[model samples]
Target: MPESVGMILTLIMNIALFSTANYLAVKLSTRNVKRRIIAGVVFLLFTPVIFFSTLYLGFTWDDTGWGAGIMTVIYTGLYLLNGLILLLSAIHIYFKK
Candidate 1:
């Protein structure tokens, strides 16, 4: 529960999520350059939308107990997913072949 421990755990989790997303994106796109480009663009647009929506929900929600715990998980998952997507998409765009 220490701040340093929490930061380290968060860093590890983000790296894991980003790695998974990168793998999936490569597998899904395979040798299709066009597919990868399109997916990158689409996810580029979607990432910020998801990020802002998550922030909005976090600020508006007032639930406690199980509800709050569940929401936390959901929000974290969403934030991680979108963030990884954004990063992977940018990589793809920059390294386009």
Candidate 2:
């Protein structure tokens, strides 16, 4: 199978895992805002970790220059986009008027 196929399958599998984990974590925790927030925060952290790990695996198997450039652009764009969104969210949450 192609690296892209592997990447797609990995991405799909991780999404399922994260979703189920989040559901179970929140469901099994004692009813409290802290537990839910902790689960959400952990889910947030896992997403990018899983994404980059699968991306790294794909990178290792891919060889084309065009694929490299496209992946670089995608990876950088996603990092910047996610960082900017998180920054904005944090500012809004912690600095609300």
Candidate 3:
């Protein structure tokens, strides 16, 4: 497969993952503290998963293409952003009256 195609696919997958995380966070925001905490923990755990998966993808690709490398970095960064958002939401829920 071409590097551009791989990059596009990676971007699409990143968008899907990011949107799903945000959707779940929004849905969980109204739930009880326990569920929010659990969701936050799950999100936190996902950060390392994302890191490892990106590493695997980077290594698995046959070509050392700049496009793929950039996309991988973007993917990892977005996952970290999602994790932060979820963690903050959980913190807010915990402090709410």
lDDT string, candidate 3, 38-68, tens digits? 6667777787777666656655553665555
| Candidate 1 per-residue lDDT over residues 48-83, each given as its tens digit | 554454444433443333433454455456555654
Global lDDT scores for all candidate models: 0.54, 0.54, 0.68
Clashes of 1: 0
Q: Whose lDDT is greatest here?
A: 3
Best by TM-score: 3
Instruction: Show model 2 residue runs off by greater than 4 Å.
Output: 61-97
Q: Clashes in model 2: which pairs?
A: none
TM-scores of the models, in the order given: 0.45, 0.47, 0.72
In the range 8-70, model 2's lDDT, one tens digit per residue, is 665565456545764586465434444545554555565566556645655665755455445
Cα shift from native, residue 95, model 1 (Å): 14
Is candidate 2 or 3 superior in TM-score? 3
